[model samples]
Target: MVTLAEVAEHAGVSASTVSYVLSGKRSISTRTRERVERSIEQLGYHPNAGARALASSRSNVIALMMPLRTDMYVPVMMEIAIAVATSARAHGYDVLLLTGDEGPAAVRRVAGSGLADAMILMDVELDDERLPLLRDSARPAVLIGLPSDTAGLTCVDLDFVATGALCVEHLAGLGHRDIAVIGEAPAVYERHTGFAERTLEGLRGRARDLGVRLLHRPCDPGYGPTSATLARVFDERPGTTGFVVQNESAVEPLLGLLRQQGRAVPEDVSVIAVCPDQVALQASVRLTSVSIPAEEMGRRAVERIVAKLAGDDADDVTLIAPELTVRASTGNAPG
Candidate 1:
């Protein structure tokens, strides 16, 4: 492999100048930088990751930790991955995608082994083990989800309670009374999975004020609808005239099942979902939903981390509001 020395020699510049130009340690004229870059391309000179880390005492790489599963978070994960990669590249950094199953072991391995300069964590729970490890780790890190204890870490997330209340308020204004809510299953294994449930709480609280009862059904937290779960919902709450679905994974299947049961959206069963706009758009019928700004959230998380890295005072927590997109799927309760 061609070294920086060969590229520098070919470009007629010293190795130190080439290093400075590549690291942006000291600004070289644009002309010289361009010449070095061209020489690097011609000679196929790739910077040594280990040597670079040792010389600079920093890795130009960031680790993104999430669950790499297909069911709960594929869409959201894709959004964060794209945004984080793009933003990191713009700032002269690269990303290392990691999964939740690896936990603190991932952080320890990456930072302790000089794999990355920093980390971005996702899908955090109320009491995530990674939080403490990250806090104590020498590397700077940011979280895409907030923990119950937000004492020192920087976090970025959506205001799910507000999102839920907004959905209920939107439907209530259209004169819907009896409503059915489909949400993620209550977290069973010490998971911080209350985004949907907390939103339902807000909706139910508002529903009480409006003199209406909100019927809730929690799905099994999968990528598709479970007939057994849906049947239990309908059986227990037969009077539901509208629906609020929280799981994007189950959105299509639930809609299909609803159609199979001869239910007409808006006219017979008004619907609203807490999902990304892309998912809502692909539905057989357009759905009115509280669109989660998945990409924006991810981008913002990276921005916050970069800012902190640059010695800027970053906010301890940043909450993004879900945007409501009104469509044909929601309307007045049937006569």
Candidate 2:
């Protein structure tokens, strides 16, 4: 195996200089940095994570907790993973992804074992049961979703309230008075608490004042359930001229159901969704929808986590806005 000493010798620099370049404790000139990087690439010298952690008391590993489901949206997860990995690598850190299936045991294992210096918790709920555990953990942590309180930990989330209102305002401007909201689920258990319901509330409030008839329906994350749910939504809300889908995971199933029902996109009914573009495109439906920067959110969350790990304050909550991307899926309401 190629060693750091080989890279340092090749780069005409001391081993400590190479370490400094790797750690970013001191800034090296671009020219020297490039030489070191080239040497590292040539030697393929990988740092010893265990040894590094033992020396610095920082594992340089940030734990990412996500909801585990075999049927979970792969693209969304990929985006988050890429962002977290990229952002952490830039700061000389690594990411360890831990799924929800691991549960409280996983939380205790990661926190108590000191395997990670910090953590970034994703898919948080308004009334998250894990919050108490995370708060009491030995490591510092940040949440990627909005929780009830932001008093102590760092958080990053989107403004779902504004997102909901924007969806209504956009449809209303298009002269649609009757619309239907398709979401993940209603807030019942810990299952349905996040930006989805908040956004729905925002949309409903705005739609009411505009005399827009809004029918909110929940679509199951699965294909069969979502298709069946959307079909029911269409049949029950016949007066609905437009549809706004807040759940990205169910967008594909919704599109499939629309096709099965012989509903032409934007021609017979207008469609808008709150999801990423890749998801919209993957469904082969060019949708006019609110785009969430999932990757960017992951990256920012890791950056904040790393900062907090480094004795820096990540006290503030960062909220990214949704960007509306109009595409072929939307058009004027049918007469």
Candidate 3:
């Protein structure tokens, strides 16, 4: 009989990867899955019948808790949800979306009712209200965002702190000292959402280190609100020549507003953003930005949950590194 380790070696992957492929317990790339299946065929490998039967005894579903809030950018959230759903399906599991802000009640409900074998939480707070229940629950759970505490939790997310500092570093390196951070909506910051909070923390901390002035204004979605925020940024610091925008909705509007004020991009002012690649590319100005790895976050969350189910030792914290792409929107500061 061909062993799992032999099959893994044949497929050029780890033994756990071969097991995950056979068990359908984790999301594997189509190419890798195909290669593994081919290796299994060549080796006449058969998965353990007893283990498959035991795995089938559970609900085989994963619950995703995501609260749809007005302050959030829905497209990015939906993109992540779709990624999670797709990845879960690839692992031979169905997804049950719990899109309500039920807090710990949802955690308790899912765990107590045996509704799902595992859970993946989104829109996490630094001090999430549901962490206590999740930590104590017998079920496996994964968080797509980091929290302040991770004593007994598995989390996967972008390193927003590095992202913030990277954005500032890019602008400051170009000689733009007074920078403005047009951030997410007031409600997002008020809620202390993990991503927003971390980005602000990194931006402020790095500004202090670099001896640069950072102006952060939380702006609502829409042209009027963005315009208002921009006016205030200039009002407070008329010398603001560089921008680090975190809000997806405000990117284009800020650019348009700046253009309307007879300011040529990179000539009079520079703009950099923290957003998805498509957003950065599609902007009126091809935005210099740090791409948010939403799909990667969703994918890693599923892998962690599946690894836990497979009784493998998974890391408690997984942070994807951020990379900044410089494009046409930013340039040397004016004298």
Q: Which candidate leads the pack in lDDT?
A: 3
Please list the C-alpha lDDT of all candidates, in the order they appear. Answer: 0.81, 0.80, 0.89
Task: List, residue by residue over 1-335, the lDDT tens digit for candidate 1.
Answer: 78989999999999999999887889999999999999998998899988878977888888998775455656877887898899899988899989888888899999898888889988777787887887777678888876778887888888877887888888888888777787775452226554544576678888888877788776766534456667777787777777888877677777777788898887888889888888899998899999888888888888887887788754488888778999978988888
Cα error, residue 244 of model 1, in Å, equals 0.8
> Considering only N, C-alpha and C atoms within 3 Å, which residue pairs clash in candidate 2?
none
Positional deviation of residue 216's Cα in model 1 after best superposition, in angstroms:
2.2
Models, CA RMSD each: 2.6, 4.3, 8.5
So what's the TM-score on candidate 2? 0.81
Candidate 3 lDDT over 1-335, as tens digits, reads: 77888999999999888888876879999999999999999999976544543656567788999876746767778888998999999997779989757778888888887778899999998898899888888889999888898888899999999999988889999999999999999988888899999999999999999999999999999899999999999999999999999999999999999999999998999999999999999999999999988888888889888888888755489999999999999999999
Better of 2 and 3 by TM-score: 3
Candidate 2's C-alpha runs over 4 A off are: 1-47, 70-72, 185-190, 256-262, 282-284
Q: What TM-scores do the predictions have?
A: 0.89, 0.81, 0.83
Q: 1 or 2: which has the higher lDDT?
A: 1
Candidate 2 positional error at 180, Å: 1.2
Steric collisions counted per model? 0, 0, 0
